[model samples]
Target: MRIHLVDGTYELFRYHFSPGNRDREHGATLGVVHSMLQLVQDGATHLGVATDRVIESFRNDLWPGYKTADGVPPELMAQFPMVEEALAAAGFCVWPMVDHEADDALGAAARKAALDPSVEQVLICTPDKDLAQCVTGDGRIVQYDRRRQKLIDHHGVVTKFGVTPESIPDYLALVGDTTDGFPGLAGWGARSTATVLSHYHRLENIPDAVGQWEISVRGSSKLAATLAANRELALLFRRIATIDYTAPTFEHLDEMAWTGPTPKFPELMAKLGGAHLVERTENLRRHRDDDRPQ
Candidate 1:
């Protein structure tokens, strides 16, 4: 069996900015549901979607520069709860994250699904860099970027980041993640960070003195000096970038199965002026039911 874990927050952002999607009464929320239903139409049976109920999380307390709702457009911010409601109404398992972000929830769900002996593959549906760490060997679990039509397995994670899956948080710590709003220490570019981290694998493992370095980076002296001076800050950024697998998202893959839309789904779709989605989901359900043989 295979499972699909979706980043509902990313989907919302994608559809909201997509061409000709802004004007509809509830376009962002409805478009997200339609797209997930497309995944169901394409043979995804067990699925879970994670959404950021409130943009700010406990990470805010850890770092003042952590991401928040302040930068997001008010119109886009407003659609969050509506997205959760619509997906839940459609019978998809929805994790509406509050203290933690959607990324951690999807990671936790992926971890849970991959552990089941009956599960063959777990596909995390997001293009976010933070998710690359969750990818595992032999395609047991992977990062599926639906928009790009790409599958990033463990090898892909290594090729992309020049480090193992275990090193991603360290890599992001050195390189800084503008998306998450955490700035890395000075003198740490992508190439330099990857080269150093590919060798050290973790922030604390790297030697503080440039003279003791085994591999030579472009500006090792300055990078080492900056890192030595602000080692605590670097570790903090790594902590912020790390995806928490123990996010209390799911325990069983069977719990994520899409049984069919809930009774209230049609009414919710009508309320959103997306009556067409009701017809689409109904047709898809009929096809699925017809295909199931006794």
Candidate 2:
């Protein structure tokens, strides 16, 4: 069937920042638990959630400007650990990343799950542009933005970023991700980077001189000069943008299939003031039990 891979870190950040979400200490955690239960109720069988236990990953060591837990609201940061445990109690496979970021785990899980012949589709549930690189042209793997209810396929990647999924890292490298805290080449902006990358595809593929470039770009001469002067720096940014697929994932697809909540789920929900979720989860589980072929 289909595999639903969620970016738990994004969900936590989204709900935590929403209006009235911070009033309760566990508001974000409770919000995420409700979302997961809703997913199961909506017919998701195989599902996985990846969360960043620590915001600072190995990328921080590679570049000093890389994203860290710094500046995140104290209430939001406090929910990171709680979200993972709550999702686990709700019977969802949670990949709590330590050394690697949650994006790496989502990429790894998407790639691995796509390999299973039995999997009809692998849906990575996140609007993060970085994860757009994981979408495949064949549509076997795609991204579902649960918040907006939007689906991004290979074509969507090209439409949004003006480059193919394969060139996303290169595009991000040249244009830079302010969210990830890296500045790209001085003159490079989204349109220029996308236009250049749409042709060259990768940093190394671009020629050193403007005259050497087969395609024309505005300020091609200056862009060429900037790229030539900072070749190694651009490459480093690309390396950081590329997802580390070696990040942890399940050994078997069956491990991702939801069975039911654990015994601790009720207690956990009670503590989080989400006891209503307990009834909803039980109803969903009971419905699944009745639907299963005996």
Candidate 3:
């Protein structure tokens, strides 16, 4: 069995800006529900989606500049609950993350699912750089980019990032991610950061002296000085980028199984003014019933 884990937060953002303006109020919710259903129709058996119930997380207190709800558009923010309800009404397992962000939920689910003997592969459905660390070399857990329609395994991570999956957090920390609101050390770009990190494999391993470096990189002096000056900040940024697998309490794959929709799914859909979603739920139920012995 292959387990599919989706980053609901990213999907919501994508549909919010997508053209056609299909729905002013419920377009994102409808898009994400249809997308997940399509995945199931495409043969994904065990699936899970993680959404950010609250934009702020424990990481916010740890880092002053971590991504916050302050910058998020009100339109997009308003659709989060409706999206969760739509997914649930569609007979899919949804993790509406509260204390932890969606990234953490994805990471935790991937790690937990990878341990199950019944699961052959775990596909993390996102292009987030932070998820690279969870990719295993044996193809057990891989990252899938829906936009590019590509599956990035461990080797792909090394090829794309110029460093192994293990080095991605360190790489992102030094380079910084505007999406995550963590600014890395100054003077660090893709080329220089990859060169030094690919050799050292981590921030702590890199020496402060430029001459002591084993690998060759352009402008080693400048890179070394910037790293030395902002070493603590770089580490902190890396911590923010690293997904916490230990946080969520879901211990077994069985815990995530989709028994069916909540009892309130019908009423919930009505409250959101998504009557079409109610029809989709009925269709899903009929399909499931048809698969069973009659």
On TM-score, the candidate that comes out on top is: 2
Candidate 3, position 58, lDDT: 88
Write the number of the candidate with greater TM-score, choosing between 1 and 3.
1
Model 2 earns a TM-score of 0.98
lDDT of each: 0.90, 0.93, 0.84
TM-score computed on alpha carbons, candidate 1? 0.97
Candidate 1 residue-wise lDDT, 177-276, digit = tens? 9888998988799899989988888998899899999998888999999999999999999999999877768766677988788999999998888899
| TM-score of every model versus the real structure | 0.97, 0.98, 0.92
**lDDT tens digits by residue: candidate 2, 117-178:** 99999999999999999999999999999878999999999999999999999998998999
The alpha-carbon lDDT assigned to residue 47 of candidate 3 equals 80
In candidate 2, the residue pairs with backbone N, CA or C atoms under 3 Å apart (3 or more residues apart, or in different chains) clash, namely none
Q: Candidate 3, residues 109-203: lDDT per residue as tens digits?
A: 99888888899999999999889999998999999998899999999999889999889899999999988888888889998888888889999
The lDDT, on a scale of 0 to 1, for candidate 3 is 0.84
Of candidate 3, the 10-residue stretch with the lowest lDDT total is: 254-263
**Candidate 1: regions farther than 4 A off:** 22-25
Best-fitting candidate, scored by lDDT: 2
